[model samples]
Target: MGEAARYDVVQISDFRLPGGTTSSIAEEVRAQSEAGLSTALMHAAGSVTGYPIPWSTHIRRILDLPGVHVATPRDRLHATVLVIRHPTVIWSTPSTFDHVTADHVVIVVNHAAIDGAGTRHYDVEATDRRVRSLFGLDPIWAPIGPVVRGTVLQQTTEVPLRDEDWVNIFQMPEGAAERETFIGKKPVIGRHSRPQPGKWPDTKEDILAAYPNSPGYDVQILGGAKIARRKIGWIPDRWTVIPFGGEEPFDFLRRIDFWVYMHHPDLREAFGRAAMEALAAGCVAILPPYMKALFGDAALYAEPHEVLALVDEHWSSPEAFLAQSRRAQEFARSFSPQMHLRRLQELGVAVPETGATRQDEPAVAGTDAQAGASAGPQPTFVLNLDPQDLGLARELTRGLSATGSPVVMGLVADGAEKDPLGPDEIRLPGPPAFHLVEETGAGTWRRYITQRLRRLLADVGARRVVTVGTTIPEPVMEAFDGQAVEHHWVRPDDGSPLDVQLAVRMNAVSAIAADAAPETLAVTILKESTL
Candidate 1:
């Protein structure tokens, strides 16, 4: 197989798992690959511990990149650097990967906390020792940021975390074409995070202090205020409560004057990636005083009670507001992919000098960033799916993808999610390609719809909904942006003639692959329904 396809770098992480790790690693790989490097990304996030975390869409999208390979398990790869994020996988099972040989360095970037309170917390000292024993090379300990570093310092008698912070690598979304200092209207203040209970302060006063609905200010929260609403008891009259992912990250950041973030007192704010993204968007970010170590002058910090006065101070002077905004963007460069590439080189990875573009920070918002401003909302297709329909969903997704439009599929099942195929019946669906109908532990599949896919549908403006062999979930229905959406029900029974007919139409869909409009595909599917 052509000398087994050697690579310059091999990155391992549990990708099927969601959240920022996979996406951050993918961004780093993309940057390296763009600089004319052969990089291999592997999904080994839960492999060593025998957890069955599945492949994520990030890995799928990453695989499509020109020089990046999503390496399969046990695929022997030669590399100069073998970078692993949150390195519990190797620390537990030394044989988890016997194939990757890092000729120079093994950079262990920590994305998790050191405490074992969570299910997947990593021990920094243990990981460093283990990597040294396993590879005979002392691995570089790179904490994501001060928050992550704070945890590492709790027991720093063993390994010293380098001064260079391996903060979460992020690419800012399209920025607002015009930078307004909020002079004419009330200064808009907001924050974006998941609607989890731990994301907020303990009291209503503190919550309102951070997000005031005062007549002098406008509050726009992109993440749903479920916990905040529960704490406040009554929703604020003027606060524009947008469900998380209801709008693109940059779009929401653009509307706000300041990116105000405050976490629950009990939980430590470990490297606020969302806040960093805000800074990259040139939005003035205000966090609690503790975040000052990581953000410094790039963002502002104050206690809950002092937030508005800080805002008033900034608003009183347009020059100060613009200066803070510009400072935010400048500080965001420290976490860009170019900085990641430089970080990789510091650890002995021989990055090629051929790509001169490697010297410059990547342009986060350029002309293409302005496309979404004028381009009206794109159509989204939400495929209501069940475990029984994964094979069908997989096929349909292939056809839908060719249509050049976004698709949302929420196939997660509530309660006890057994495998779709019973022990006695194996022929229908076979071994599944996607994740389960249900996943136990922290990120339950039932919460998948409410937490993730629903917000994604909202963000993309899902206009057409299709349910095959099952009724749409009520939770999904509640989140659909009102009225414009069209819902269609396909054959209500699994393995019905509807499957055969639709499968044939989907197979024929390749013929119309050139048709990029989602409306075209929707028309074809509805036309086949009558027969």
Candidate 2:
């Protein structure tokens, strides 16, 4: 870019990095435009990897380019070329560039975008269509790959079971923990499948009715918050919604009884992770007929949309689900974490078995910290209220209370504080199950109420902590440091981040513990005597 600039000046703009997008970019472009410099617009394109980009984000970047008119010889020499496109912006959502306006858009396409079959064939088409619909023009589709196609999606290889008995983990709808024991344990049926369109059982009620008369049979539904909510609505009374009370979904997957493939016929996968996990857990795989291709005779196959039939005939028949579970264990004894890492390394991704990726470590840690409240077993759950968003709060409380004893600490403006449930308070789904802790402050400033919150958490329990704050507080962060419970911050709408974080943290810690100290971790694996 500098060499081209030596021949002629260039000022690049983008929606990534510091000041690449947002008001700063607008200010920069406005400054240059006002300075009478002739500017050229350069736009970059690709998938948005991880950073959050919305439809109007590109406009912010375009607004920051100062030389939109025409660059003079002096302008060309002195002008700084701002390259706004980076890997992060490309891998994210595609419709993030609708509002952007550029005189000339230059796309920096990477090899992944150019040569990858998934990207070039499907993703690129979808992205271009979206851009055209929203922006009234199509950006360039530059191919930078060396005209070579990579391998088809990899197949799963089995890994050794860490445990003879099946263990599964998953995030619950309400932030809660669940553990169930099958007495006699003769026919333990582990289901690690999800509800998919037209593939999963018609409803939770119908699925629950499967093997209704059969006693000592349990089915645990594992999923994140959305799935948890759906399960709550559809769960068969016979099947229990077990909250793998953890910060990460994988933690719940780690402790499941066995794996069931519930994907719809339309959906195809290169590899079935949950099915592989069931094999790893020494459980049999009861796969849908369609996904049998992915597993072959290694797993037990059943028709889709027939969860009840499968449960009654295949799972409920004498020694059926159990027999299949053992076969699954034997099948999944080759795909280790080391193998996954090695594959990524061969792809030039340089994934080390230990240490961290230079780019992803801090962000991952920060994300984990934010998602997993650094709390111990008996930690306090903080609930901040803005009289307006009480509906959301009540929904959270209802979900939490169903799984664990949640301590709700409500914060309000000085004069606004009233009966724990004020005259204007919306009726909670049920009478408040939470122990009410109140803090009164001058306003919604989180800093002002941090001291009161720290005291409240200490008084309750500091082992496991979750907070719902309208705003992030410096004091609360300090309190988290002191208490060590995973802390999470959520906007009013995107509340699931907290749930997923908790699920992930629990799984990671469980993995770390199981890998490091198998004996101690085994005892805590929810057995009769331990419970």
Candidate 3:
């Protein structure tokens, strides 16, 4: 045989074990390795672990896998710089990209809300920019579920059942054995989630109060620290608080009859993996109205006040409970690892036919004119600025105006007051475009601004856009997607007026060259930097 095709795939994310929990992105990496892809998992930041757990131990544990390789760079910044030079596919988990540039990047979003709390937290504009910066293309977003394998649950042994406890019913694969067939005398209600403020509803105390010290029912709170911190006025005998780490989530979930998640409506879960895992373990899930789209009939919807009543209704009727449990189990199967792999393939992600070694190629370097010539015909350039940076924008505009390149200035109107200019006013050679993005209570105005900036760039036929600001916002950096366009970020404190002008001009030229010869541009920049 000649040479085997390389199956190199790198996953960059916040991965930890033992004291900390692993994200769904890490799980996807594991699945990819099992499918015959040569996979490497790198920590987005430094080695993540609980106290007393050394980084070497974590690495050793992860490397034990047959085809999985693990690497923890000095820090996130180092990893970001390293991946840009690597000649292999790089996958970044949610919201890790900073100022670093990459050619082939696949970003996976695990949650709906990105920046902060509430439904509007989905910073559509920033997400779009992030996709563009990583992929060098426009994004077409679609909701894709995570790949949760059965193996995540297999690590922990099963907890023995009690005669007084009612087992949660679930549907198995075709022709699989029917393990559970009876309902117990007492109901064992449970809640499994990170014990965070957002995950709990405002009426948490009321729900806990419902499970009083009685023979009919008992409550168990799994996942999180001791319940003493909650200070919910309930007797010690009423409920059991199982802190994380003693047993795996599935082990605790398997023992519970119902899996209730009473998260606040404001907090959005991109895809509730824990709830899905509960479903896989045959626990009938109780979710809020917001989760309807994700879980469908797989879970029972209940308001905060109706939680106790809903549980009572299910407890009274065994047939109805079993049907819902079976539905949830079936729905959970849809998020299988195999299904995720196929979805990735459908999205045009390359999979190597045969495993082989990675090719280490040095980047090519060239001058601005040569790079521009190779990039094809010269195109228009725009200088974008936040309203606060209007002074620098003016200086850069005046200096670059002499270069004879068709340059325009654009202003982003954030909610904050502008020192010199009003909302609609900013002086420039050509009519300055004002993008008014008012901040609503939803906290997503940055996204709106990013969207407007993208539209402005496209409208002006901007081949290269230079942003002059104190510090470029991550969202704004992301908006400069598309192979036809190049984005350069210039800080106000970089140098004197002449320095800024020269830098802008050079960057403009560099952008033109970058469009034509990315490899040459990378080599040139790498040579200049210590990295």
Top candidate, metric TM-score: 1
> Between candidates 1 and 3, which one is better according to lDDT?
1
* lDDT by residue (tens digit), candidate 2, 1-531: 111121111333333332113222233334333333333333343343234443233243342232232121112122222223222343343424322333322222222332212333234444445444533544443221212111111111121111111111111123222223322354344454433343244445434443232455655565422443364464345554543222233455445544555543334443444556556554555665655654667676665445445555653454665566555554554432343223223323323334322221011111122222344233335354444545544554444444443334343321212223321121111111121223322122232234445544544443444344344334445445545454433235533343444434332122111122223322322121111
**Candidate 3 error regions (>4 Å):** 1-8, 16-21, 46-62, 71-104, 114-124, 127-179, 209-213, 225-236, 349-531
- Span of ten consecutive residues with least summed lDDT in model 1: 421-430
**Candidates arranged by TM-score, highest first:** 1, 3, 2
Per-residue lDDT tens digits for candidate 1, residues 178-228, read: 355563477888888878887787799999898887888888888888999
Residue-wise lDDT of candidate 3 within 1-531, one digit each (tens)?
111112245555444332113444445545555555554455543222233332322233334343444322311111111211111112224434332233234434343323123223334445455556654554333233311111111221232111121111122223322126323567788877765666666454645544444566767777652433464544357678776544667667767787888765556565676787778877778887767866788898887667778788887888888887788777766666666455556545444454542222111121122223233333334354555556655555544444434445554433212232222122221112223233211123334334545654554455655556544444455455443565554554544333455445433333222122323333332234221
Task: Please give the RMSD to the true structure for each candidate, in Å.
Answer: 14.4, 23.7, 19.3
Name model 2 segments beyond 4 Å from true.
1-199, 203-216, 223-235, 243-258, 263-270, 304-327, 330-333, 349-531
* Alpha-carbon deviation at 163 in model 3, angstroms: 48
Q: How close is candidate 3 to the true structure, as a TM-score?
A: 0.50
Q: Highest lDDT, which number?
A: 1
Q: What is the TM-score of each candidate against the true structure?
A: 0.62, 0.33, 0.50
| lDDT of model 3, residue 58 | 25
Winner on TM-score between 1 and 2 is 1
TM-score of candidate 1 on Cα atoms, chains taken together:
0.62
